[model samples]
Target: MLTDTVEIDQFIRPAEIEAILDQAAAAPDSAIEAILDKAARFEGLSHLEVANLLKMDDRHLPRLYQVARSIKEAIYGNRIVMFAPLYVSDYCVNRCAYCAYNECHSFKRRQLTQDEVRDEIVEIVSMGHKRIALEAGEDDVNCPIDYILDCLRTIYQTQADLSGEIRRVNVNIAATTVENYSKLKEVGIGTYILFQETYHQPTYERFHLAGPKRDYWYHTTAFDRAMTAGIDDVGAGVLFGLHDPLFEALAMVIHNEHLERTYGVGFHTISVPRIRPAEGVDLSAVYPNIPDDETFKKIVAVLRLAVPYTGIIISTRETAAMRKDLLDCGVTQMSACSAVGVGGYMAEKRRRETGEIDPTLTAQFAKNDERTADEIIAWLMSEGLVPSWCTACYRSGRTGDRFMALAKSGQIKNVCHPNALMTLSEYLEDYASPEVKAVGYALVDRELEKVPKSQHREQARRNVEAIRSGKTRDLYL
Candidate 1:
């Protein structure tokens, strides 16, 4: 059954998933320690093992957090990768019940022109973000593949009026054919991200009522066509509140397993986005299924152990407090100063001081964290976390199976650590506020000492001074 093609039925079996969770509920306490020990060693866990850990009682929660933190420290070190989201359009053909941009809504729809995208980039770069996830709603006739390509080209090529550059662009769009994905690859996208929304076919169909997205097989197999087209680094996720979170988690692990067996690599990143309040969606049917803070932490920790090699992303949908707490439970990447709407960043930035609204800004979902990117980055540093701006791996040739091998062997730290500090140096020089710049530079020096090799530390020191003296930009290992 493990063939070259993607089969939805084989990838996610609802009955099999139900049985796994049911059995895990009766698993002895000893099973928990055994699984946690393996996870601590970074061997990763099987879906059945993850299911049992998901059933961990309140008493085992501390050990779960400790193992997850240890694995994160061993693999990714202490830096949290940061990126921002730029919504090109909220125009859509879908009537999904959980979205604010559901086609039925009468809100004004807008897509960024090349000029508008340049301005958004100016604002985004001004905030010190070197990477961004390009977001848009699904509408083929109105917002064609050509438009998406144009936006990608504009993002990568334009040197904004303001002083900065967006080095990496990750795109999230509707499912399409292999040829279209190949075109995106040619246009130079970093990661081709598509969320499964939920793996339960019945609920998937129910929520995606009136769009091409309603096709369960096409939506689920998106990664297959993408990888087939040679875009191997794809990020996968679910909306998280649509079905039982435990079942969804198990199904997602199975989905990753299928990709690995067929394509020789699993997901490059896994995003855990919880469904939140949207402009026009009916949430009366959704509130009951939403996971509270404690349950959410449990799921995130289990996911860390379930897929140890992949980067896990949490957006600004969660509160700043919760995002801070999640670090201990193994979240490696987060979006800072993110905009969930077309032109939201610039719109919010200009009126930020006065609290005025920008008419052009329209959000797809409510964001719980309202902090500016700079404020958040400052808070992260104060809490002893490195706010990294590195895209060296992507810009370098390390991706897909190549990146996986380095990450699995725990050797990525050699380059990633120095690369993160070097980029942080660039951010400090070009964008950081005077006070922030001073603190950031000091932190860079301290972390530079831990760069693992005398040679790397020397090179990083020279690069930092070069950036400080305005001699170079975009230096990487």
Candidate 2:
């Protein structure tokens, strides 16, 4: 089962955390420019300036957004990395007060067996998702370390003699021992994700009063442990509504800095999830800290200005209109068609109960924006954004620092956009709905017209037809 029984506690020293925050707080606007210039030249941002940017005011927000957009153009371009969350289980061992999965809640819990998990992956893969984030609750019985590893191994190894590939499998599980982190690396994870929820110590304590995750340092320094265990790419983020947005944003920058200083691998991705009304959860009484839309955009834009090279991900916790508006402003990655229950993707007759399968019995904080993956991609195309499915970073060793460099330069689009269209065409050919296909085909034709040369356009057309004709080739233009 690859289970490790060791009780490990690896944390960043409090003095180190304090030192970073102090430097960040002391940095000035000129200092921030120096940092941004260095990032442009060296392909990495200074952690301190990122934290400083979070403190920027409304007066400078517009300029900050412009710089962020320019930086995004240089690095990621208009290509939006697309993925989906495959909920494997909803059983929890933590009682964090703000979470829907808290154990104190009387909601039913459930887990997917190996076959059920494979079924879920099949559904996701059919939707042309090359990357998936595995979401699980934190109970050993419900989601054992061995089970998670097996799912990954099966995901990667199952199609050894098959046709399609599920290129990357990112995991979002609770904090665990370095030993477990090592096992996950051995199992081959793309990115190990665990949100600090909030970085304010007292608030963190109050929010997570009765769980092992309540240990602030252990949870906060998980990426350090992951990096220590040789997991090159790790993602860090926060639940924005749990604490003041400004404070959380500052803390996130500080946390990214700590990783860069200690392990030389800053967060590869930063996610921002706001609190949503959920089953058995009272949003008003529990989280009075939620930021409004304008404030949320500011937080996102500030982070972009702060960490010019890092990938920013926004999830379905936001509405369609909100996501559409924000994509070009700062976000680079997003989740579509996410369901927060085990076996939730199975067709109705085929669906199995993950804790009763009742609407009132589900684990999601709220219904997602309800756009299918196809619908989302079509929307991206309509907006002149490329829906990317390329896993070149991991495959080509451009992850971590290598990836950061290319992203900061704005040079990544040359490779990313064409490849994204290639992958999008692959999805459209296989599983797109008629409405989706109509929109996607038209978008492809339109985007092809934007290609610089007729020769490149001819090759792209051939690739698209190849993809449609079920004779897909490697997508290296």
Candidate 3:
């Protein structure tokens, strides 16, 4: 069903790429300010407008930032979707030059056993997270498709003996066969996420020097394969620092647009992961380095206005201040307390259980935001933003294309807001610390007043009690 192999090389013309870069490099402050103001009005930015914003200099960067922030607030509102990374394996086969866990790095690698993974789920559940993005390094033999399926099975099977549970588990692994994609669909994941580190074929070829991941066609066509396998919800992203951000952003938007055209489904989430420090990895040594803060913020804002419906994810790679600031500027999803090591949660649990600390597992990368899940929720509430644990969109058959339909029509908020409030209430009743719960309760009351009807308020109130009384409730009201 996938039309004439979807390749990044084919979709992004060299001339177009040069044009975006040229525009970025030569844009003036007046031009940049005009684009920002225009984008803030929700009329959406043209390719030229985005190029101009990227070209904006530091002297006028603050104005671009203001525009990005304004556009973000207008589209996404104050809801911040929270999830955590559940690292299933750190064993990789690709010899990518930038990654810390690439095969050539010789770092100690580990894969979690099913029991160990279950324990990790318990730890995350205890901390009040309801959505998890499962992460694993690409290794067919070490971390095969079956192994991922088992991990998903264990995650869905685990229960807290309480009301709230891990509602969604998004997958982030390397590209694989169509049969494997079908297996992933059978596993019932919320989103199948894969990043095409860079869209420039030559650079992509250079970074992915070895292993199956080197097959650029297979990697780029993963969304098509997943869709063919009945996995309608897939996420696409790129490592911004690997290539020119301007080129990558345009390619990314085009990639989504292509999917929409062919499969009637686009990426459920589009992530903008920048380069960060990792063991044995040096980002500065690489060409086309990380974008500065202003550039990064502008890229995200332009993406938001371009594809307003897709959930834009920014991860723990960003510092806390940067993350908090960026949330209002276009990012709708974020990770909390991520542990990119096998049995990391078990190691923590063992330390607590035995009253003795064990050696920490070798992490794949360093996480900047070390705040626990509880602390993050408290911060969001204090900022008057609702930290959501909702997976209603995924569960209620409103994902990928269906979700986009709601989002494009400006009706997504009707579902997103109510579900966010409901999920926040569940977190408060079941897992939050007393102080955190008190703050959450107050915030819920404030948020409920903004809900259109008294009926939803009553249903939300009842659901909170149901969750407290050990009765599970569906995400929909």
Candidate 4:
């Protein structure tokens, strides 16, 4: 068993973080441009260099964004991987002030049964999403490790009558023991995500009035135990509005660095989520650090430069305009048709059909981009972005350091790009409106030519033909 008494100071080191930010605030233009040049060469920046980029003037923000885009294209090409969130239970024992599902709220509590999970899975699969991020609030007794394991089993086995099924299930529940994580790994889970909420200990403690989450060290180091338990692919994040965005950003990078030094790999994915006011939660003490749109873009751009190989995620919390702009700034992953409450997908479908809102339904936080899967898919195709439903890496035994190596050496695109187009083909054939199908097929034709005429591309063509003919599905390199 890993002890919570491990030295947290060695990893986070707030004093050192402040000192680095202090020096970066005065960095000259020559130094900043040189750092940008290094980042453009695919040499990731240090924590101090990332901080300096954050302090750059608004006049130079355009160059920063340009370098970010160049690096993204260099690594992953013009594809955007898509997934959706599934909230199973909202019953909580934590008093997290920013969450609508915090225990202090007055709404009725709910936990989905295994049958209900199947219902949700059918809804998600029908929307043509192959990846699912399973979410739940922190309540051990009502939502224990056994219950979560059961939910995972149900999600994997459940198939939509529309001839669809979820291909990946990424679990994002609270911190737990290594034993529980091993159980999750046994069930073939992908990416164990738990956010640090706020790395500033005082703010974190103040906001989390009561609960197991109030333990600063334990929550901050969950990934350490996760990796030790052999869950190689893990995701990390901070609630950006909980503290100074720059500080949180630096700490997050440092945490990743620590993982690289301790284990052989770092965070496989990084999420950037901002706080929004919830319907029944208090936010009296959370103030002054909310990043404006321009500032948020800067954070994303610098993060892209600092962690050139890591996947950056921008959730549906951002507006459509902001999400569109962020695609150019460095966001590689996005959530479509997301619902942050228990059974939100099916409930939403009914609401759209009958114009009836369920009074009992509540969300963790409201989503900013509320478009359906087809609408968002059409918009992505119109913008020349290939909406990918690819889970090739997870299924092909290429994750953690192995995946990172392929990505860094520029060989990942050999398989990833082709897999992306084939999956897009799958979506069009399975569940797309006439308008969406027209847009998607044209994009696929244009994109297929961009794939160099290798066996990968040829196989992609054959697999796509197989999918369209309804002979074989779920094909990849």
> Which one wins on lDDT?
4
lDDT of each: 0.87, 0.74, 0.79, 0.88
RMSD of each: 2.0, 4.5, 2.7, 1.4
lDDT of 1 by residue, 1-477 (tens): 222344545568788899989989988889888998898888888889999998877788999988888888989988999999989988999988888988988888998999999999988988888899999899998899999999999999877533388889999998888888989999999999999998988888878889988988888888888988899899999998998888888888989988998899999999999998888866776546777899999999999988888999999999999998898889999998788899887788778778889875668889899887778878888887788889988988899999999998878988898888888887778777888888888898899989898888899889888888988788888
lDDT, model 2: 0.74
In model 2, the worst 10-residue window by lDDT is 1-10
Candidate 2 residue lDDT tens string, 70-144: 777766767899888888778888887766777877866777777777777777776777888889888887678
Order the numbered candidates by lDDT, best leading. Answer: 4, 1, 3, 2
Clashes of 4: 0
- Decide which is better by lDDT, 1 or 4: 4
Clashes in each model (backbone N, CA, C under 3 Å)? 0, 2, 0, 0
Task: TM-score each candidate.
Answer: 0.96, 0.86, 0.91, 0.97
* Clash pairs, model 4 backbone: none
lDDT of 4 by residue, 1-477 (tens): 464455444588777888889888888999989999999999898888888988777777888989999999989888999999899899899998888887888988899999989988888988899998999999999999889899999988987854488889999999877778889999989999989998988889988999998888888888888887889999999998888899999999999988898888998999999887678754556467888888888999999999999999989998999999989999999999898889888798799899988889998887799888899999988888999989999999899999988888888988998899988988999899988888888888888888875677778888878888889788888
- Model 1 worst lDDT run, 10 consecutive residues: 1-10
Question: In model 4, where is the ten-residue run with the lowest total lDDT?
Answer: 1-10
lDDT, candidate 4, equals: 0.88
